[model samples]
Target: MHSIVFIGGGNMASCIIGGMIDQGFDPLTLGVSVPSEQSKERLSKAYNIAVTSNNNDAIANADIVVLAVKPQIMRNVVLALAPALPKNAVIVSVAAGITVESLQSWLGSPRAIIRAMPNTPSLVRTGATGLFANDQASQLQKATVSSIFEAVGYCCWVESEALINAVIAVSGSGPAYFFQILDIMQSVGQELGLPEREARKLASQTALGAAQMAINSDQSPSELRDQVTSPGGTTERALNTFRNEGLESIFRQAMNSALARAEEMSKDFSA
Candidate 1:
């Protein structure tokens, strides 16, 4: 078994570890390095895995190192571990906007690295992750990294590292878009006379059910939507109102703005 070390024991790290453990990965091969004594204790107690405050010590035996630290501090964290990193050990970074090029520079070598864009839903083991591996990484190394993310949910590879920003806008920041829609729906339900609790439950369940249908059915979302939106019916009226208000154009502009911001972040973090 490849000994895996998590450089930061934050919620995302814990979720990945929990998913791996749930998939029956040996806890003996897993370890975490956390700065906080409380965090170290919490991870140890919760996962029954090795925990340490010394980052180097935690990674000494690791075949795969997951840099789960925030993007702003990722450079310092990478530099601190550069000396101790195993020559061939694969480094997988989950920090947003931190490119593989930046990581290689930080490490001062063409170390095998993979950049992952995973969303918040990962905490519940239903994440959609976008991965981009550096040229130094081999096929086996890519698969190894894929297994780690796949333990939680879906994994898709992009050809160019720059495409990671697109991934960030689409999947990494995608969950919030859904949540926003749900919030609006729930509020509308309340305005229409449902109790707050009932409004929330109804809106939430409808969203969930629609998503499930999209997944289960081979038909496109547009086709399914058309199926439900009969001419002169309530669904049709609501959808027509949305269309009349240029909802599609609004969504397009919003997503484009998101993509642009993600690109800006790439530049900011790379510096």
Candidate 2:
């Protein structure tokens, strides 16, 4: 059993802990360091794991220390735990915009580090995570980290950290974009005289089914969409309108904007 420690007991950390436990990881092998006594108690009660307000103690005792704190607090947390972190312990960071080099510098060593960006869907075990590991990470360390994420959802490895900004735009913030589409569908359904609750249910299930079909089918998304859209049919009508209004271009622009923001944040944190 791997001993994992989380430096922050926030929602993402809790989701990971829940995923680990569901995957048959012993809760006792997990530990969390949270600043709030109430948060610590909540986490301990929820996961039946050890918790403390002392970050150093958590890092010293674990084989893997996950830096789950916000980017703003990450450097200070790493610096504080650097002295106590056992040699060879792997550091996994979920803090957005914080680079591997910055983390290594704050730790005062070329530590084995894996930077991951996982979105809110991680709470439901349907997350998409993009991982980038530093040179110091061993094969075993990489495999272990991959397994942890795989248990929760899909995991993809990126060769360059620069590509992670694109990952953030696509997967990190993807769920919110889907949610907005769902909201619009729900509103349209209700406006068409469908009951509110039933409209919401249908819209949500339609979204879920379409997503699952895209994942499971061998056909590309465009091909699948064409399969549904008969020429001069209702679907074609809507598609035509969307195409005429440049929906695809709009989405491309939105994702590009998001990627630019992520790069800006990375620069800000690095500075």
The lDDT of each candidate is 0.90, 0.89
**lDDT (10s digit) by residue, model 1, range 165-241:** 78887888889999999999999999999999999999889988998899899999999999998889999999999
- Tens digit per residue, CA lDDT, model 2, 43-132: 978989989898887777678888899899777778888999989899999988998878878888788999999989989999999999
**Distance from true position, residue 89, model 2, in Å?**
0.9
- Compute the lDDT of residue 170 as modeled in candidate 1: 84
Name the best candidate (by lDDT).
1
TM-scores of all models?
0.97, 0.97
Q: Which stretches of candidate 1 lie over 4 Å from their true place?
A: none
What C-alpha RMSD separates each model from the true structure? 1.2, 1.3
Worst 10 residues of 1 by lDDT: 262-271
